[model samples]
Target: MNRSKPKAPAPDEPLPVEIVDAHTHLDACGAKDAADVTAMLDRAAAVGVGRVVTVANDLTAARWAAEAATWDERVFAAVAVHPTRTAVFSEQDRAVVAELAGRDRVVAVGETGLDFYWDYSPPAAQEEAFRWHIDLAKRVGKPLMIHDRDAHEDIWRVLEAEGPPETVVFHCFSGDLEFARRCVDRGYVLSLAGTVTFRNARALREAAVHIPTYQLLVETDAPFLTPHPFRGRPGEPYCAAYTLRDLAQLRGADVAELGAAVAANAQRVFRLPAVTARELRGREG
Candidate 1:
């Protein structure tokens, strides 16, 4: 399939505080090599998107994400066979994902979970893979990043049945306030993406307002779900600034304060190492 290329708009005003892009696909965003990744990160950093977690949906992409994390101190990785690809998931695929999940820079064990919208994979296959990934996340002692789409109940059921990992994050959370409350009550983190910026996403925006600051995170899910005003265009980690700003407005909170809280939540959830001032400056230099 020919995918639309990302649209690069002029960078937004710099955020008063730095934040992390909890989930993105650097490879799918057309970042081919170290130089390309660096260039993207450079643009992100200029707007205070200081760190990013590039995720993978398959074995080859998983390998690339792991290597990309090592390329920059600011980049981390999450690896798994996406739910849609679970139909073809095999023992070898499982082994590779398990291996990658244990890597130093592979901070999360997902982009996994249920996706019932597409018929590409059977529900059984998706469930089985979701269970396996849940186990993998527990075994590797990393947070489980979920990709729930039109399968919220099944997603919750499987997670409850499998006994989710200590840290469970609903990537690009698509539920309303009630679902958000359920997740929050269960101690799950909700990572909001650009979709929250859409005018028609009233429910999503409302959910965002109710989520406690400590349980909130921000992501771009780049190359897709670009924020409004730039919707239908490409998105990147830097574009997270737009989402963060919008979210802060919805919550009636200060942008810098919210950014700091979200950054802390990401660090705690992903167990990211604290970057020294010297190292941070070196990257900026």
Candidate 2:
């Protein structure tokens, strides 16, 4: 059970409790082959992650995930043009994204929002692309996963304009406590990732403490933000355990209780099937 070993999980494995990684980039997780994905999923299943919402940054990634989802029951896809890639969302890109949204495996439209931190695309372009994603999510009757980085105010402005999405989630939410309050007032779900388990991520910790439990979610954003204790290593979906523990500590709740709640939250937002502990155990075996 070494972290780096690649192996197949038993077809009907069982886990102690099921976990749902509300966000991740499986394409970026070095899972370029079936063996790689099996290893990833096995490691995750070993640690209780039963499902994950894998986000794609562009049309190519969307197509990749769309195909992957058909092969892995535990993997679900989210299609969108990332903010940094806004300038690349050509007409063809929009058509493909639209088409992908119609797929059964595609659950959300996202990782679309303002990222002033990188500014890879012009502000106007990012905004326009973000609005388009919101519109697509609305049309498709799916949730919207936003990625706001140093552009909180602008995100708020656009959110106010578009109004609440069918289900609105702030992926890898790093906003301040006041912004957290604003998001809560708007009934937005805040998804905390591995960053919340970092010692210096007091803002994320604060958000975990203050945000309503029902409005909070956990994700790995895998291949990134591996969280404390496992920092400095390639992240994976199983690391949701660390995030779950951290949030439980922040909210003064039991680990198992928090795990169950986050798993349910992920299912609700993504419209994923709810697996009983029995089914989760069978998958882990």
Candidate 3:
């Protein structure tokens, strides 16, 4: 959908420490093959964005995400029928996603949850799919990454009712300080994205300050919410550096210290390898 030309933004000075992109969409970002995946990661690694978890929006994308993870050690995958696509989710679709969720490189089950902004799927359908994905994440013993867009209350309702997965992540967290406090109290991780850099997102910025260092994560949601200044342009994983810098400044924490904390949070939530094996594989290639 993002047909903008795939050009890397001017690179930021690399961070003193590396961090992982807790969520992204490589396929949607124009990464079509192993070469594309490598090239994307190369750009990201240059700015200390060392690892990524590319997530799926539908059954077809789920399969692609699984395969892409195998193409590079730095890349991991999350599979699910996005809330918007719940209108078409069938028994066969669930079977496919379940299989993908159990794959070794598939670290999370998500980009699920509710989205009231989009009417492509009815509320009942979205709720049904969200519950199913929660169960799948529990079964697979993986974190559940949520995509909440103007549907926070219902999202919270279902998550609370069905009971959340052990490791719950509010991807691109769009809640206010009060709501953030509840999520933190419930032990859910809040993943900040480019939107937090927007001048108008004052509430989100304030909420970021309240989140404990270990409960925070960063992401690009690439090809979507590019950070400020480059707001209208296409975003790549490498752009995460800008957001990391902004977040560090907002929290009044050193960039390196914040980066290290987020990296640890991502590694813990996704159960990523201690080191990025793909960087070595990339050099070998």
TM-score of 2: 0.91
Count clashing residue pairs per candidate: 1, 10, 0
Q: Over the stretch 27-127, how does candidate 1's per-residue lDDT look in tens digits?
A: 98889999999999989998989899999988999999999999888899999999999998989889999999999999999899999888999999999
As for TM-score, the candidate ahead, 2 or 3, is 3
What CA RMSD would you report for each candidate?
2.3, 4.5, 2.5
Clashing pairs in model 1? 7-234
Worst 10 residues of 3 by lDDT: 275-284
Query: Considering only N, C-alpha and C atoms within 3 Å, which residue pairs clash in candidate 3?
Result: none
RMSD of 1: 2.3
Error of 2 at 138 (Å): 0.3
In model 3, the runs with Cα more than 4 Å from the true position are: 1-8, 277-285
What tens digits encode model 2's per-residue C-alpha lDDT throughout 119-166?
A: 589999999999999999999999999999899999999988987576
lDDT by residue (1-285, candidate 3, tens digit) is: 867664556878898888899899999999999999999998999888989999999988999999999998889999998999998788988999999999999999998999999789999999999999999999999999999999999999898899988999999999999999999999999999999999899999999999998899999999889998788788989889999999989889999999989999999999998866445656778
For candidate 3, the per-residue lDDT at 108 reads 97
- Which stretches of model 2 miss by more than 4 angstroms? 1-16, 276-285
TM accuracy, model 1: 0.96
